[model samples]
Target: MKEKQIKQFEEALAQKLYKLDTEKHARAIGEAAYIDEETFISPDFFLYARCLVVVQGKEFYEYVV
Candidate 1:
């Protein structure tokens, strides 16, 4: 796919997911930034965790922003 086409697709998808409150949706068990106990996961893993970080970018975009 071309760059512009990819950008368009991303914009469209981002809007559909924009309404979600990721923090509330995600399960939080440990303090972010620094932790010793429990394993920390990407916020995108709230519902489905992907083995690859790139595939999980949607969650990262939704939460980290």
Candidate 2:
């Protein structure tokens, strides 16, 4: 992604998280993988690389919970 686009996405992420109730909200690993050329293998080899999924939408919430 371009620098401008990444900045925009981060801003939006912050905005969305700001409206949540801390007592009921939390963060977790969404998806994770290193995308460098050294790993032409797959996107699952890298562990602990969190994607930071938000607890939103019925389907996504159920998947995480």
Candidate 3:
């Protein structure tokens, strides 16, 4: 993705993740960040995760792990 696209993705992902209050999802994201600093730290994962959130809503929690 272009730098602009990547930046947009990161902003959107941060917004979505910021809305999450669940400990499990928060911790899982944190662990993923630790395991793969490059991927998790970037917002690319947001593209996939945003789709899941749009499709699954609250059930998205089940797939977080």
Candidate 4:
């Protein structure tokens, strides 16, 4: 890709990344990972989890959301 196209792609990815940082999605991650009342998850874990979900591309993000 050309320099301009690469910049555009980065900008688009940033936008999608911003959109994925939502309370709804975060809650979903926590809910999905829940394995009884003793299960605990850290804030950093959720952040990384959201990043993984976003990198899976639009199709997966939309499906998960």
Number of the predicted model whose TM-score against the real structure is largest: 4
The candidate with the higher lDDT, 1 or 3, is: 3
Candidate 2 global lDDT? 0.41
TM value for model 2: 0.36
User: How many backbone clashes does every candidate have?
Assistant: 0, 0, 0, 0
> What residue pairs are clashing in model 4?
none
| lDDT scores in order | 0.48, 0.41, 0.53, 0.74
In candidate 2, residue 42 scores what lDDT?
34
lDDT of 3 by residue, 1-65 (tens): 99999999889766766655344343454444324434444345544544556457546644553
Off by over 4 Å in 3: 22-65
| Model 3 pairs whose backbones collide | none
Candidate 1 lDDT tens digits, 1-65: 99999999888765645544345433332344223237565555433322232246767754544
Which stretch of 10 consecutive residues in model 2 shows the poorest summed lDDT? Answer: 41-50
Model 4 lDDT tens row, 1-65: 99999999889877776787766676677555534446675767777887898889789988876
TM-score for all predictions? 0.34, 0.36, 0.35, 0.60
lDDT of 3: 0.53
Worst 10 residues of 3 by lDDT: 33-42
TM-score, cand. 1 vs. native = 0.34
Measured with C-alpha atoms, the lDDT of residue 59 in candidate 1 is: 75
By summed lDDT, which 10 consecutive residues of candidate 1 come out lowest?
45-54
